[model samples]
Target: MPAGLTVALVAGEASGDQLGAGLVRELRRQVPGVRCVGIAGPAMQAAGCEPWWEADELAVMGLFEIVRDLPRLLRLRRALIARLLAARPAVFIGIDAPDFNLGVEKTLRAAGITTVHYVSPSVWAWREGRIRTIRKAVDRMLCVLPFEEAFYARHGVDARFVGHPLADELAPGGDAAAARRELALPPEGPVLAILPGSRRGEIERMGAPYAETIAWLAARLPTLACVLPVARPALLAPLQAALSAAGVDASRCRLVEGQARSALVAADAALVTSGTASLESALLGCPLVVAYRASALSLALVRGLRLIRIRHFALPNLLTPTPVVPEFLQAEVTAARLGPALERLLTDPAARATQQEEFGKLHALLRCDASRRAAEAVAALLPGYRAPNEP
Candidate 1:
């Protein structure tokens, strides 16, 4: 390992952890001898990152959650900035998980460390003011989506679109047969997969309707097997309670913890609560009903920032908005409505074919080996680069 160049990276959530790991692999490939350190999860650590703290500690979501964790987040950011200033890493790469990464980038950039923000903040969606913050922090921006490049250019930020890795993985067509085999279930049966959400607040808000939707589907199609791939097991009891209150059997509902990808792969038609799962469902080539519900207060807070012009929230629909799948949001996120949407796709071959076609187009756009491109951008900023295979 070389002493002249060290890169400190911080990724706050599971998604960021994934992005960070890929970037580390790419960066290592470019500069095999460069020292890579700081807060990272399993993927980045596996890519040879030396972790200074648990990155999960910074994975808090939503407005109130941020406020609650503000002091700790600030303290962590200051500690990272101080260490970077003291040792002076040549470049600081802040992966997704904006709130945790942005301030660190700002402080480090002010202190003369080259800064790169690996993922653009949702400046295109809710916060227009973020452009100023991004400009103050990042020296270069690496964006996964194609649309983001234009946005960064408009704001005068150095940004590049390196293509999306999910696109590469899913472009080859989704494996429905393999998914069914892994679950040990017959493809003949009606399979309704429940993806509440990754965040606890989201799971709490969307979990009841999700379980209720499963119960309704199970009753309508008795042969239907419900698979709920839960994110936080702490909320599982409450979710099961919702199913019981609706007269749905807890035993019948197979709760598989940490099997989100498997659940998306196996389902005939998934009832996915909005967010990352929507994209995963599309990539898996599963026709899905997108349902999302937020507390009235949470809803009110989000409504305050109305910069979003996109008609579709689900990634599949957003990619090709020809009503490929039903998007039931807020009050429209009912079990009755979602159940039929899933049923329609499951029973109708024509409908599923149309969806599969659109999903194919979306997958093509996202399918680059994202980590490699991302790593190249980060490594290009480092000095004295060496390929990992080189002596």
Candidate 2:
């Protein structure tokens, strides 16, 4: 490794922060004293990446939300691009946040710096046409899912399936009793994990329905315990307000800060939002009901334009050949539907076992030591680079 080797990165949310942290650790191991810099979070910062801007600044979601924050985002991108250009690192890696990162990568790549996108966007689903833009922007795409490599291949893009880091971080079927003890939850009752989302917009739209579902379920099972994991400190007050308005029993529900995986481990079942949280619940072997609600205009455009390509929205469902979990979207995300779906998981042994079995298979498929593989892929892009194990 060179004395002044540097790698640039940008991770937009908590999940991406986790991914970025893993990638940074592996890169540091492969090349000692490698300098990592760009937009980062606490996890990535702890892993040794110097942040040019915090990841939270780029956390806006949905079409309307992005529009509202566009001017500020553009300014941030322009400044970041100029700084990165001056640094002239070995390679630039964009962890996730395709909308923001891809543009940054495209500009940097045009200036003769190599660019890599860590997570493949949902081109395999809706917005398949974005492949054209991605082709010009990314030198390589590091995919977490197996099928994504082939999808990019057909479009004449260079891609590699690096597996998912979460699959490697978490084991299949975690110890519920141990996790319950650590979280101070009831040791001998059916526990349910509720994860609305990591973003403010997501909780704003889904919190009411999720709170109502908890209230509905509490009425049925006297011994039912609930654990809700708040992704960020900013979301705590709003989530609490929603639960209070829905008349959910504050005594039975415990709100933990940022230990979502632990909350899922302690839970027998979960009501998870339809993105990374749904995937995390499945990986932890917790039976779950997946639900999502977005802005009215965004939902309308997706539905009216017929932009969605797949029948299933949840990551667990998309990963499997057949959908194993129930999902409620938009208007379908109601207490009436979500409550019953979760109830089945809690009460029916067969239903719980079925989902768990499928989850186990998916977990095995994705546990490919992803961080090392992603590091190797990034290493391949640098001039005169060689793996430590190689001759």
Candidate 3:
């Protein structure tokens, strides 16, 4: 069969790449021999996308960081728009990365191409004004959270609660033994997994203190081992340097390229940096202590940003709006504070079990099977787009 429709999908970061990969697989399954192309990481490439460029290079975070890289990003985006318009795909699917994808999508939509933004921008949080921009860009918005549907409806943006791909991907049970063996962990001791995020800026700002917190906890609890899962080896150099500079041994920590699922599943508890990891940790049934720190400028920008309805940050807590996880931010983040908080989470079996049970409920709520819904939404835009698994 020949390709009847073409899809240009753009996914800027690791999380977005994972979502994009899932969407691609579903698109192929639903509409076999669909031509997929655009900026993507390895996973999406494996799903049969001919990359216009590596999606990693497009990953510039925070307002200030993006400002510094604006000219390059703009040039890249313009080139992308041209290629996409030339190819004239049946639809353009922008997966997350709202700051970057939304603008490109807006341009493509104005040029008469059907546009779909896979993940809704956080209008439910800060920057509610962008809902209008989303309406301008996207014909349909696929929301991962249930509450997001109401949020979009209030803002007059078309949306569907398509559930989260993570819930579908994560198996309920964990493999602690496999994780321990893979990382050469001690067979009988409790383990603490540390995920400080994948960005370079995150490592530089929070690395030293996070490592110090690990060392502090290790000293107090002789039986506890620290497992630091590296998002990328490049992001780990600063962390490794911090361990060396602080007179701590790197041998005390295990560094991994990824396998965040394994690390979280194997751990008794986690010291996670404030993004998607906290959510993954919950799904893995790991109790968590979330932490984050950014430069004054970026932090200030975040502080000044006018937030709306969303009150919680972590997904587990956000889902229930209950005090299920601990989030330590900026000024409150200290080695002394973090270590004790981590220790407390580790020691309390009842609390940990309660949180895990809550996460299980959250998982069931989010396991509504998103890809087919998203594909159907996209198909609604094409000439004769038929959804294979229509709901």
TM-score of each predicted structure versus truth = 0.92, 0.97, 0.95
TM-score of 1: 0.92
lDDT of 3 at 229: 80
Clashing pairs in 1: 167-366, 167-367, 168-367
| Cα lDDT of model 2 by residue, 302-345, tens digit | 78877789889899999987799998988899999899999889
Candidate 3 lDDT, 269-347, residue by residue in tens: 9988888888788777788988877788977777787444566666677786466888787887889889888888777
* lDDT, ranked from best to worst: 2, 3, 1
Which residue segments of model 2 deviate by more than 4 Å?
Answer: none
How accurate locally, in lDDT, is each candidate?
Answer: 0.78, 0.91, 0.82
Q: Which candidate is the best by TM-score?
A: 2
lDDT at residue 81 of model 3 (Cα atoms): 89
For candidate 2, what is the TM-score? 0.97
Per-residue lDDT, model 2, residue 171, is: 76
